[model samples]
Target: MPGTTPDPRSPHRGRAVRGMFASIAPRYDRLNRLLSMGLDQRWRAALVRSLPELVPGQRVLDLCAGTGDVAQALHGALPSGTVLHASDFCEEMLKRTPAKFEPGAAPRLTVGDAMALPYADQGFQAISVAFGLRNIESPQVGLAEMARVLAPGGRLLILEFSRPERKIFSAFYRFYFFRILPLMGRLLSGSEIDAYRYLPESVWAFPSPAEIGREMEQVGLVVREQRRFLMGAVVLHVADRVAR
Candidate 1:
């Protein structure tokens, strides 16, 4: 997002965010497990569980697939006839995904940006993003694009970090997030771009769950359910595109 043509709405300029992610791709998953105490995996599982039941041959898209965790999970959970596609803007991150799926059931992987997705209108029955929306330059536009690609009454699942609700817990979480996590991330990834620091900054700056629900509604998606985890440090939002 850092190096692209200047857009006032995006938080990271084009290339800057992408470059940071690319730099850390090797150790990203390891660092995530260490930092979140492996809760990240459970959070992802929660996202999968929150989805509406899918029929055979239905299509689903996992944006910001990030080494294919969500994609793999979706592939495993959905009916055998369902189709899953995993996409991300960072090729290095995409490259980190392993060839673990059965030959025929592997998800179709693509390198693409979220703000301007390459999909056609009403192409998918469900779209999901996990912990990646905050990294986008303009989340509002990203959400709109996601809604655009979903069929009428299609599901949208988002699992993202959020501010903690408790005062004492919030203070402690901030201390660890801002102070401790960055150092660990740097040691793990060996990147000098302060990538981990950006994590907290972005989460703090991003819209709250309520605000995000409103944003979804603005783009013709209605929030159907919301769930919080890890004492409100993370949230899952399930929305449905308005039927025509």
Candidate 2:
């Protein structure tokens, strides 16, 4: 995440990270659609449908809210007076989204760090991260920070790509992920970015669903449920921060 050479030790170099995302921000949406063949929207929809812990009028935070994908849909689900706070560290990426929100887009976009969210303890009723945890230096610290912002009995929904269970499918997916996806990303993004290449690699390197749930439990968040899809190639993990 530093310069063109990757530093294995710390992947989340703030300024450098911003430039990386900004470099690809323009083609981000188009590439997501083309590469995933529109499965990205399906994944976002699944996140919305699977999110059961957020009540109608509760305040919620969308961590690493890239271009208002989750935030826009989430705003529709909330009742009157419900608040949607979307934040990301990359200003250029955020700017790509409409500066003035669309009708019913109740989001308040802000530039903020995920590992150190700008909110008091128990400030939100629900917190969610979609396709963002892998970018963090310490996902545990980010998760703990999210839990810290949740109110009593609040829940967290994390949607992320995972390692596929089927060997053959995993191999094929790997081919598409490592080879095809990155090729298309480079072609469309018009830059020599290895971000898409890292996507598949990171998914393979990331902890399994059970491991993530255990991490949540360790952080004092009770893991209530988990749903894995595409032979475990993707997972939506849910947990709660109960009142002490």
Candidate 3:
């Protein structure tokens, strides 16, 4: 299970996804700030604040750690002696991580896949993955792997786009997300591909918070909280690995 790759026959599959991220790696952070109108920063900040306090020697893993934003935030929040590790399948994205996040006490960075994490069972005390679950080849497999690497009672935080509950706002948000945002991202990132286009489609296809909660439960993670921001356009799902 740890080494399994996504189905090759799936259209716009994992390889395409990886290429798209690599193509847009340089402008990814800028587009995030611009497209989200800086709310992305606040969302991540809230997640950092919500994490269980870390003791010295504790380990936190930031999976799908694009550009190291969450990793940087966790590093800042954790005490000096705790270990912070960040991993991403896209080496380009990992390379683009700003040096400011990894000063003297740098977080260990690894190029890894979420569906097949290369860690022992219960290896981490806290794990966070932001805005990248939708890109995984199999979100269920990814979720299960998150449960696998987490210690008993460990925290798991997932930040991702979600459907708005309100009807009128949902319609408008869909228009902007499917049409306007893609155009803007295409122009800014200067990528001929459909990275921006794929983003909304993936998010739209992603399971709702409730469904995700059930999947987490199936993987032995208890849903501790589900917080919606920007009127449910974004969701932060927090869970705890159940002690066996």
* Model 1 CA lDDT for position 226: 81
Clash numbers, per candidate:
9, 0, 0
Please estimate how well model 3 matches the true structure, expressed as its whole-model Cα lDDT: 0.85
Displacement of the residue 5 alpha carbon in candidate 2, Å: 6.1
Q: Where is model 2 more than 4 Å wrong at Cα?
A: 1-15, 53-57, 103-106
In candidate 2, which residue pairs clash?
none
Which model is ahead, 1 or 2, in terms of lDDT?
Answer: 1
Worst 10 residues of 1 by lDDT: 1-10
Worst 10 residues of 3 by lDDT: 1-10
TM-score of 1: 0.94
- How well is each residue in 1-244 modelled by candidate 1, as lDDT tens digits? 2322223235656578788888777778888888899998899999998777788888899999988888877777898688888899999898666565776667888899999999999989999999988878888999999999998978999999999999999999999999999888867766766778888878888889999999999999989988999788999999998878
lDDT of 1 at 7: 30
What lDDT tens digits, residue by residue, belong to model 2 across residues 3-85? 45133236554555566677777778888888878887787787777555555567888888887778876766666677888
TM per candidate: 0.94, 0.91, 0.93
TM-score of 2: 0.91
Query: Tens digit of lDDT per residue, candidate 3, span 112-142?
Result: 8888998999989999999988788888899
